[model samples]
Target: MKKIALCAAALIAAIPAASFAQEADSTEATAPDGTRAFGIEPYIGIMGGYDSYDKRSEFGSPRGGKMNGALIQGVAGVNVPIGPAFVGVEGNVAKGFGDIDWEYGVKGRVGARAGESGMIYASGGYEWVNGKRAYSDQKDWIYGVGVEVGPKDIGLGGVTGNSGVRLRFEVDTYDFDSIRPMAGAVVHF
Candidate 1:
């Protein structure tokens, strides 16, 4: 939707001004070697996965009244590290195959650092989904938990150290209406 895109753009544009207004402090994110992490890290990635709906009737069945399909998505977000923990906001737009048409959402994440550049976090947000014209569109609240392991933690530190790339895995519920699982890679800057 135009509104969603505009809102996400506004949020991303405001990050720098907001972050710079804050004074540097000891609470800032730090690496294992005691160096400060990027004050505000912005990232983007592409993910692919599946979405299974709980109510087949609402989504219209392409296969024996069963509503489910594969999805590919684009993701973007920013993280602010605070000591060993971090907080961030992310936005995603997805295209679906089979019974689904499209999906989009925005979420907020909060969690602690895991092994060098890795992170362990939980997220919640609002999502809008569109299915085959067999039914009306739907929107709901979504919640999930995920992890991101940097190349260094995965044993690529020697080659990709500070490259800002990480592997991400996540699972979320569409307001208890559906189960969604996704995985991808993200690069921060």
Candidate 2:
């Protein structure tokens, strides 16, 4: 009878410890940082760079020129994981150069986390630009490659859940004759 009582006591003591171990394992797996590994992140960003339009002659005079300007883009997108790489789609609106244009695209990137602070990624996307000009309205496809570096915890406040920055550089082209480099920064959510 004493042996049975002691066995019961040992089992009762082990129960709480076993429960604690399970709780601790779950906590480590479902932590906030771990949850950020993949998701949709809507962000607002600004880009400042040179823009060059194809030289077209209107009424026998050169009309397109290269200029420096600032652009504001709003992005809504999701990041998906494939093994060690990530793929995403972004729908964006860019307003600049006295006009507003709509761009929707898909981006593919290979990236890894940097400690507990941020991630570094190299990405490329295909974008379709549609808008009007002084002469007429047009649509074109632009392909580019770029790099982005930003915080791991991207949320309402910022990179650290308060305020953080994202940077990108891309060279986009509509045709062989029209290629331009663009760079910009975004205050991530």
Choose the strongest candidate by lDDT.
1
Candidate 2 local distance difference test against the native: 0.46
Question: For model 1, how does the per-residue alpha-carbon lDDT over 1-189 read when each residue is reduced to its tens digit?
Answer: 445644654564456346534635555645453546557878999999999987554565555565678999999999887655667999999999987899999998877678878888877789998887564588877877899988878789899867788999999888766788999999988
Which candidate number has the best TM-score? 1
lDDT of 2 by residue, 56-113 (tens): 4220113444322345555555545322234455555556454324434554443433
State in Å the error of residue 161, model 2.
6.8
Candidate 2: which stretches are off by over 4 Å? 1-44, 56-70, 98-134, 151-165, 186-189
Error of 2 at 188 (Å): 5.8
Question: Could you tell me the TM-score of candidate 2?
Answer: 0.50
TM-score of each: 0.79, 0.50
Off by over 4 Å in 1: 1-29, 33-38, 56-64
